[model samples]
Target chain A: MAPSDERHRARMARKQEVVAAKVARASRDKGLLLVLTGIGKGKSSSAFGMIARALGHGMKVGVVQFIKGAFSTGEEAFFRRFPEEVDYRVMGEGFTWVTQDRQRDRQAAEAAWETARAMLQNPELGLVVLDELNIVLKHGYLPLERVLADLSRRTAGQHVVVTGRGARPELIELADTVSEVANVKHAFAQGIRAQKGIEF
Target chain B: MAPSDERHRARMARKQEVVAAKVARASRDKGLLLVLTGIGKGKSSSAFGMIARALGHGMKVGVVQFIKGAFSTGEEAFFRRFPEEVDYRVMGEGFTWVTQDRQRDRQAAEAAWETARAMLQNPELGLVVLDELNIVLKHGYLPLERVLADLSRRTAGQHVVVTGRGARPELIELADTVSEVANVKHAFAQGIRAQKGIEF
Candidate 1:
């Protein structure tokens, strides 16, 4: 082999050792608390993907949509197809700005939380997705401390994914993994109405 | 009614009119090019979510996976269940860093691109997810100009979602919607192994 090729192989071998060591270090197995948040799209979509992944493994999942339920969504329709595997619920009336009724919104949020809390408690549910729960918390419709406490109370090996914009810092602190989907550009801004399958 | 309640209603009514005007202005109906990129998780997962959404709407979709085919994935397993709606293809042998074979990787990318091109030409496929195509472009495995040209050739009502880290600037410029999944924290970094449903 050429000198450059030989050098490259050696470098890769060294790097492989490092990665292997890191992989070995991560020996523990525990269900994770994941938070997908930011002022961009895909947070809830990613959670829905995880729902599919969980269902792929024959794992039971529960979905609680806390806000933005004014219209039906593609995910809701898709996941609901598997009633046995996916326990899907659309609990929000709409965004707080749209609802314009703090009492009604709070009641909706509390009802959604009750459902999420029940799912969290059930060890049989391998994954629980709280879609847009962060928005409910952000609007002060639900108590953050209580929500965090319930998340902590989930049984071992029960993964939870919380999604929405403006995730609380406390929730971030308690999460095992956190991702922020940052908006670079949006189609709606360009005079394109939200499509059925793609957006809703 | 209370004075505060009356004032709030008036404010909401005024803001609703403003939003209504903007909604009225958005009259265009065209297929969009969506790009999901950044050094974070969920780019491919979001693409899979879109696949599910499209399938729910009875829309045909094609998926071309690049740079990550060393092991089987949950998405491949799940989406394969719907053979009628999803044309799933895993073309990449592995990442370039792991494969360490540029010629082989280039061939794999070329093959994947060929599959993608076929999907793009068929307007019957409502959404074509070019999973990890960005990585191929970033690594110069495929020509960006050729890829962009093919994307532009897709029928007026056909949508495409390109997902991977390190998206080309030109691709972003061409895309109607763009999002960057920013990594805040990863569980693997804390010595936790990647779990099946959540990571795979």
Candidate 2:
């Protein structure tokens, strides 16, 4: 290509760069209700990231782990150390597969929902993460419509994140930002197994 | 509470739900980049959701995997079945910790960057996921400024995602959406081990 042609391309590229940056900046101020859905790992992990970020910004943060019950995560371990800043709950049930009781899962989900609903209503709550929540919704353990209704009604400026696999299309439609964590290549797939502090 | 107070509370609660739903809907058409950062599993998985959704909408998609060179993810396995619709690359060198060689890592990053840059330049690309890219920037193995500049210059309709822990502040500052996965309660800590097709 001619030098002049190359220069023209460079100039156009630079112009495009400026335009893209401006557009991204405009989109940042927009609040999003993200849905991290997919048949993969990391939905809760991604949700927890937002929880920590919200807390870091001095934003009120609340977390309700539907299937996890009251256990310690690397995040809760750190955040719960200063309990005043975080409202954390773990539903004490492992998962549907482990527990293998829909009725019991439903009870735990309902119990967790009470807390989640409270968090959603709190105007001071900047971020609310419903970790592993889709399982509850998917298993029909929780009423999807009510959960969506409550989530839709969260206080202004409050951001809610719902994470789990098999997220319903209706919920995805309702979400401001819907993300699916599709299983791609994973180390564990190679028989490496999950390493603590890495896959947790 | 007085009867009037109870009625007013119900009314206000209902209003909040509507408003939250409105905000979420309005956010969809607006293209945005969300980063999933942390030591926990599932960042790439979350990104794949966006890729699949984008494709479902008949939107063009591109992916650049930083640590995973030439290997295929489960999603990739599924997605590659429709190769004509998706552009994907897996950096074969794996993670920085695994490669353990700065020069090789840089070369791998550069190779991944080359593909990513091309994808960024493609106006037709609707969603671009740079998986496990945080490590590259965190370790200074890749130039942040160039990545940022490229991202800024990418197509306005394009939504870019970056995944990995220890992302640079500049990258986070530039992100339209930022999520950090914190380790709260993980089953791995209990020696339950990561089950196949689930954890992977």
Per-candidate interface DockQ score? 0.60, 0.04
Model 2 lDDT at residue A89: 84
User: Which candidate gets the maximum TM-score versus the true structure?
Assistant: 1
The global C-alpha lDDT for each of the candidates, from Candidate 1 onward, is 0.85, 0.65
TM-score of 2: 0.51
Residue lDDT tens for model 2, B167-199: 788887776555555443333433333322223
Q: How many Å off is the CA of B152 in candidate 2?
A: 31
The worst-scoring run of ten residues by lDDT in candidate 1 chain A lies at A4-13
- Which stretches of candidate 1 lie above 4 Å from their native place? A1-15, B1-15
Worst 10 residues of 2 chain A by lDDT: A189-198
How many Å off is the CA of A127 in candidate 1? 1.0
Label model 1 with its docking quality class: medium
